[model samples]
Target: MQIMSNENAHSETDLRAEGVRVTRQRLAILHVLREASDHPRAEDILTRARLQDPSVSQATVYRTLAMLEKAGTVLRNEFDGAGARYELADRHHHDHLIDLDTGVVVEFQSPRIEQLQAEIAAELGYEIEWHRLELYGRKAT
Candidate 1:
């Protein structure tokens, strides 16, 4: 997947466009998420937002994150089996491979898989709405 520059980072306008209320706490959370390459959990957001604004609280960050996810401004995935990790939602969609040994996540896209899903849905006489396929494995050394 392509990476975006931090300069094109998130702002209150983006949150508003997503129909999310523009709050100081929410904007802070979005800013941190936009800068993240790896998906982060609520705790990660709490820590970074706190560093940016001392008044920001963990509860506020969690609430804002949930709101952002609902608004499609961010995506959530459970990678480490602890809690879901959060990333800024963009135009592209990709699957994740998790490293069981170290709990690392790698994102990849496969056109074949996408086509297969469509074919499978057609064979079953059902329409696919959305799907998430996560493959968990250890790094082959």
Candidate 2:
């Protein structure tokens, strides 16, 4: 079994400070999110976490994911009209492009698009705090 070092223990401290109760399942879910390169659906997370903690129930995982999303510790985006995919939000929010053919998601950050959005919102005399941009397309054959 791996030991939790002082530094690793501090992450739990930080998470609790963010209003999340520290639990084995919550920590497991957080670990999965941190290690996931591709945002995963709730089912994906549940399946992966169950391998780590067999006692982890689907309902617990789903509830934990919802709490994490509400705390802004994770972000959720829907792709191809399917369920929402989740990713850990550290810094720098970006957009997603989902390949409808292969079911792959590509993340991209564009300053030009960000500037255009700000300008357009300003033109409409509205202030934008957050936004979600998801582009869906199929791969070329």
Candidate 3:
């Protein structure tokens, strides 16, 4: 395995902090996730990881992803009928806008929508704990 850079080394530290073992396969998968610009599926991750370490297995990648998700270090999104895509959990909250026509995923934040959600929850005499909002629509011509 190639020596991890400072950026990826931090990811190793994060995995350790999450009480996960720092295995070669896990590190390879984590590296792939960190370098990805788009949220990628398990198959995509496995493919990229294999390019780095041929010994990395699909089962290992899947298991590592599940472990990361359980530790709240990764976010898994199942868009429409497509398979799950994974991304690192963001420090700031945001929602997703999926383009039905092109399968594009857009991340956005809206203060007005957030405030409206809070107000609606208050009106129902319930405090908002956690929520997920996903908007799906086709691109305008």
lDDT for every model? 0.78, 0.78, 0.81
Task: Name the lDDT of candidate 3.
Answer: 0.81
Instruction: For residues 1-141, write the lDDT of model 3, one tens digit per residue.
Output: 121121223367777876888998888888888787567889999999999999999899889899999988888999886999987774467778888887777777788888999999999999999889888998887
Most accurate candidate by TM-score = 3
lDDT of 2 by residue, 11-128 (tens): 6777788978989988888777776767789999988888888888889988988888898777777776688888876645678778877787877777888889999999999989
Question: Which regions of candidate 3 fall more than 4 Å away from where they truly are?
Answer: 1-10
Q: Candidate 1 has which clashing residue pairs, if any?
A: none
TM-score of structure candidate 1: 0.86
Model 1, stretches more than 4 Å misplaced? Answer: 1-11
Model 2's lDDT to the true fold? 0.78
lDDT (0-100) at residue 137 of candidate 2?
93
Output the number of the lDDT-best candidate: 3
